[model samples]
Target: MWWFWTLWAVVALTHCSAMDRNKDKALKLMKQTPLIDGHNDLPWQIRKQFNNQLSKVDLNTIQTTHTNIPKIKEGHLAAQFWSAYVPCDTQHKDAVRQTLDQIDIIHRMCDAYPESFMFATSSQDIMEAFIQNKTASLIGVEGGHSIDSSLGILRIMYRLGVRYLTLTHSCNTPWVDNWKVDTGTEAPVHNGLSPFGKQVIKEMNRLGMLIDLAHVSEKVMNQVLDLSKAPVIFSHSSAYSLCQHKRNVPDAVLKRVRDKAGIVMVNFYNDYVTCSQTANLSQVADHFDHIKKVAGHTVIGFGSDYDGVRRVPKGLEDVSKFPDLVAELLRRGWNDTEVRGALGENLLRVLKDVERVRDSLTKDQPDDVPIPYEQVENACRTNYGYFPLDNTGHSASQSPLVLALATLLCWFFGGSSYSCRP
Candidate 1:
């Protein structure tokens, strides 16, 4: 019994020593590099719990379930892409308005707390904000339904400071299939990218928006990789090779990400990472390890999806626990370069590359393809101010007096490269 007690003391002291060493390493790394989280849904949380009102509560004093000013500061989050998330329930009804509302609140949050947060639209902006000792807040439209099949809306969103677009959520958009292609009972409508979907990819590339592949289907994943000229990002996804979840990125796609010079910011959702309602810090690290093994060290980053999901892995319960996760990684033998790359450098590199692609395409023709007439008409809440009519005021038809504007739109933009179905 005495020997057992002495052994326990030694084991406990060793554990504490290891934890302290890792924590120090994590702190040192975060201080030196900009730790940019690929996705956070604090805006969605504010919209839901606070009715999009910042005046009612102070992020400085009030504590949220997963995120807050103190937790963010403790976590050493230099930048975050606040997700403009609208539920799939709003797909055809009010997705656009809801997304805008979410984005508005995100802006309001940044404006409300200028001391802690600043609006950033580019990689350089993020670095500048970090140097100023502020968190760089960027916007990401979570689901394509927000676009309502209008490429015009997408462009307008980019001008509004939205930097990335998650091609789909849990449900399918008119243009792209979602992860449900593997999990749903129904057959896929497009199988992969519809004609309009291709235009979306092209337009996003032109706008320098990061093509986020998190919630898209496997086929859509491949199609996007094939179509997008810029390096893509799985804004909040993990390696499917470990979990076999449809929501996770498959190894085939990870290889494509590697070849395309993309990044996968590993998600901390329990079901995606552990396939269970519970997981620990080690389980999350396992994902980073697996992704690093398959996609290499540079392709890995963190997207905790904080405040977006109800359940998360244990030990990574809040935004403040990021350092703990880093510590675990360090304990598992991750060197400084590898750790720094995963922390923020890799994402910064991807952002710069995306901007480069945009610069390179400055002289190129912009995408002309509009969303197919039927797709928008069926899904959008309103069709006012849509495409104009023919000279004879005739609707879309195979008429000789000039086919419907829809037909003309398809012909004008789709050409032979797109199916342009109405």
Candidate 2:
């Protein structure tokens, strides 16, 4: 009995020592390299809190339920893209105006807390902000539809500091189809992009705005990948091979992104990361592991769709939980360099590429013309065999055995899908 107790004590001490080593390593990584989250809806969250009136709030005293200056500092977020998102609705007659409002809020926040935050358009700006001990405030338009299908508006948006534009949101635009709607039970309206949509991508390439393919259809994603002269960003997405969500990118897509030297900012949305519809922390970490296996370290970064997401993972309940994720990654055997890339350096590289592309484009270049709706309607009918299968024998539309089984299960259960509780 004495020998057994002694053996147990030695094992426990070894385990504790290992845990301490991991904790120290994680803390060092966090301190050395700060995290850069690609997308967060803090502007919209502010809009909601201030009663759709940004001017009324005392920027210094502003308190938010989700994200704020104090919370961001506490969370150790070095850089973030304050997403200018507008909901898809005909009722919101001027979507562009609403988006501008959100942008104004971000600008106000930066101006109000100059010591704490700085507006960053270039990778250099981000590095500068870090050196100054300030959080970098970057901007991204969440939907292409927010521009009201005007090239002039898009240029103006870029001028106003929008770095990236998510080509589509939850709804299909006149040019591109959203992956969610197109892949759903409803028939696809446009196969990928109308001729106009292709032009939009080219214009984005020329303008230096990183053409984001986060919410676009797989066909649209392919089209943009072919059309973009510069690297693109899936600002907030994950690996679909792991979670099997329309919102997540498939392994083939990730491979193409890697080949282009682009960045796939791994989204922290629970549904996108996990098989479970409800939020689960360990499952979220599993997605990071899976994405790394497929995309490699260079292409991976963080894109936590914070306020925009319905449910966050258990460990990552709020911005403050970011340290826990860093710790978890360290526990999983990620070295400091790997952790730094996942945090922000990878994103900085993509940002620099976008700035270079923007500088190369000429202002006098011809604007992209919109393709006629009739032409788009005609093309979808003729486009067949566009959905190519992967090595696993799964096309973009549906996977082979797993999807087939899911379909049968839904049918057997009277069209009710399984829902796992959090």
RMSD to native for every prediction?
6.7, 12.9
The count of backbone overlaps in candidate 2 is: 0
TM-score for all models, in order of appearance: 0.90, 0.82
Candidate 2 residue-wise lDDT at 167: 89
Q: Measured by TM-score, how close is model 2 to the native structure? A: 0.82
Number of the top TM-score candidate: 1
Candidate 2: Cα lDDT at 198? 77
lDDT for model 1, please: 0.88
Residue-wise lDDT of candidate 2 within 131-230, one digit each (tens)? Answer: 8879999999998778866678898998999988998888887777888765675456678887777778878878778888999888888888888878
Candidate 1 lDDT over residue span 1-422, tens digit each: 99999999999999999899999989999999999999998888888888888788778676766899999999999999999998887876668888899889989998889999999999999999989989999999999988888888998899999999999988888888999888875468898899999988998998999999999889999999999999999999988987889989998889899999999999999988888888888999999999898879989999989999889888998898999999999999999999999999999999999999999889878676677667756311334445555686543343443334444555566464233322
In model 1, pairs of residues that clash are: 396-404
